[model samples]
Target: MPLLNSPRRMSHSLRALAWLLRYPDDEMRAALPALSEALHDERALIAGRLVELDDLIDRLAHAPALRAESDYVELFDRGRRTALHLFEHVHGDSRERGQAMVDLAQTYERAGLLLAPGELPDYLPVVLEFASTQPQAEAREFLRETAHIVRALFTALLERRSAYASVAAAVLDLAGERCDKVTLPEEPSLDESWAEPEAFGGCSTQGQSRPGQPQPIRVVRPQPAATRSAA
Candidate 1:
C-alpha cells in the first residue's frame, strides 16, 4: 500500500507520465517505445496502475500521429477542466497565480532546473520533471502537497472519459490518496456557458487608457547592434 518508494523507479515513472502528458508530436510518437520500456522497468513499483498507463501508451504508440495530436489538443488545450497547468486549478489568472509561479520557479532554480522561456512553472509535466530530479522522500512530499490538484484533474478527466485520466489517477495512487471528497471546480462546457464574446460590456476601446487606472508599460530589452540590424 506504500507508494513507489524507490527514488530511481519513481523518477522513471514520473518522467514517463510527464512525457505522456506533453503535446503528442512526432517526437513523442517516436519516444513511445523508450517510454514504455521505462514504465515497464517501474512496473512493480507502480503495481496495478501500470496496466492503465501501459494500455494508453500502446494505443497512442500505434495510432496515427496526427490523430493522437488532435486528441491531445481537444482534451487539454480547448478545456480548462483538463488543463495541464496546475495553478489554473488553484490560482487561475489572479495576482496570486503570478506570485505562486515566481515561487515555484525559484524552487526549480534552487534545484538547478531552469525552465525555458514561456514555460509556466506549475505545468504538470514541468512539475513532474522537477520531481524526477528530487530525492524519493522529497518528491513524495511534493506530490502529496499537490495531491488535491491531481485529484481534481483526475475527476475532470474521468468526467470527460479521457484515457489520459489514467495518468492523473496514477499520480494520485503514487501520492497515496483517493479522489473522494474533493470539491472540484465547476468547469462548464466551453461551447455553452464559457464562450468568449466579441467585446466587453463596459469597455469600448481595446487599448485606450482609462482615468485613474494605471496603464501597463511594455519593457523592451536592448538588442545587440547586429540583431537590431537584422530586425
Candidate 2:
C-alpha cells in the first residue's frame, strides 16, 4: 500500500499516528491492518522509521486485548511524564493552559470540525486529527509547532521502553524535527504533578487509583481568592 511518489500526495500519517496513540479499544484493535496500510501508503515516514512503527503495531496487535488495554493505561495514565495531553508538558496547570485550550478548540471549529463530548483539544490524538485535515504544508507546520512536546514524550516513553516511543519518533520525522535519544528527568506522582505555583492558582489531576482502571485527566481549578482585604 505504498503511496504514489507525488509531491502533492496528502499524507494520512498524522491520523494514522493519532490512531496508534489512542486507547486500544476493540474497534481500534480491529483497524490494525488499515492503520498499517495508511502509514506505508502515506510514505511520509522513511523506511527506517516505518520499521519502528511496524514493530509497535505488531506488539499491540498480538497482545491479549485486556493486556493491551491495561498496558496502555499503565504506560500513559500513570504520570504526567507520558501524558497524551500536550499542554501538560508545555504549561502544566497554569491559567495559560486554559486559554490555550480555548484557542485550540476554536481553531478546530474554524476548520469545520467539532470535538465529541469529553474530548480535550490538546490531546495528542485530537491535535493530530486536526492537523491531518489541513493542507499538507499547514499540517507539517502544525506538527512542527508541537514537535518539542512530542519529542519530550518520545524520550519519556523511551525511558520506560514502551512501544509507544515508536509512534512519537514517527511524529518527529513528520515534523522534520530531529529524533535522537534524550534524557528526561523523572516524572512525579499524580499528587506531585499537581503542585501549585506561587504566583498562580494550582491545578490538580486525578489519575488511576486502582489497577486496570484507565487513567482519565481532570483539571481542578482552584477557587478564586477574595479580592477585598478585611473590609
Candidate 3:
C-alpha cells in the first residue's frame, strides 16, 4: 500500500522537499509534477537551486524504475552518512538519541502532527512534515538548528555528485544557512560491516504515548452508593 501522506500540514514547499527525499515508489514518481510546481510556486529556493532540483526530478521521473529505486537505496540506505534518520548524525545509536526522539515526537504531537504508525520522529522527511505545520519563520528556525547535520549530508552528497544533493541544498536555502563543506570521517557501510549491538526495541519513539479515540466518561452518582448499601 502507498504511504498515506494524509493531509495534515500546510507548508507546500517543505512538504514537497520532504517527498523529493522519500523513496521514489510509483506514487512518489506520480507526484513529480506537483512537487516541481510546489518548489517553484513557493519561491523558497533560488533559480540555480531550482535548476538543480529539476535535474533530480527529471532523473526520478524518467529513469528506469528499478534503477531509480535501487540507486536511491544504494545511496541512502547503505550508509549512515547519507541516512535520512537525522538523529543518527547527532546521537548515533546512543541513549541520548532515544531521549531526543521522544522529545521531538512530543513536539510534533503538541503541534498536532501525528506520525503514521512506524514513522520515526527523527526521520528527516517526518521532521520536515512537522515543520511544514509550523509558521514559516518557526519552521525555518527548526531547520536552522539542524543545519550542521544537513550541511554535512549535503556535502557528502555533493562529494558523491548525487543529484539528491539539490534537495539538501534547497533545505539549507530554506533554513538560510550556508552549506560549508566538511570532511566527514569514513564509516563502513552496513553491508560491509554491520554495527555491534542491534537495537533491542525499535525507534525511541516507540515509547511515546499513542492516544486513541476518546471514550465516554460514565458518571455514577449517589444512586450507586445506595445500590451498593442495599446489596
Best candidate (score: lDDT): 2
Model 2, C-alpha of 216: deviation from truth (Å): 34
Cα lDDT of model 2 by residue, 1-231, tens digit:
222233644468888989999999999999989999988887777788788889989998999999999999999887888999999887877577999999999999999999999999999999988988998778877888888889899999998998899888887777767887766776676776665543321212222234345455689876556633433
Which lDDT tens digits does candidate 1 get at residues 1-231? 445453345788888889999898988878988987888887634556777888889889888888988889888887776889988887766567889999999999999889999999999999988988898778878888899888888888888888888889877766666645356657767785454534543233223445445556599999999999999
* TM-score, prediction 1: 0.79
lDDT of 3 by residue, 1-231 (tens): 111222323388789989999998999999999999988887666678889889999999999999999999999887889889998887877678999999999998898778899999988889888888888778878988889999899988988899999888878877777757888988775765464433433323333323343333578565687788998
> Any idea what lDDT model 3 has?
0.81
The true-structure Cα RMSD of candidate 3 reads: 12.2
| Weakest 10 consecutive residues of candidate 2 by summed lDDT | 199-208
User: Where in model 1 is the C-alpha error above 4 Å?
Assistant: 1-8, 179-183, 189-231
Tell me the lDDT of model 2 at 51.
89
C-alpha root-mean-square deviation, each candidate: 7.9, 10.3, 12.2
User: Deviation in angstroms for 223 in model 3?
Assistant: 53
Worst 10 residues of 1 by lDDT: 198-207
- Reference-based lDDT, each prediction: 0.79, 0.82, 0.81
- Rank ordering of all candidates by lDDT, starting from the highest: 2, 3, 1
- Among residues 3 or more apart in sequence or in different chains, the pairs in candidate 1 whose N, CA or C atoms overlap within 3 Å are none
Q: RMSD of candidate 2 to the true fold?
A: 10.3
Total colliding residue pairs, candidate 1: 0
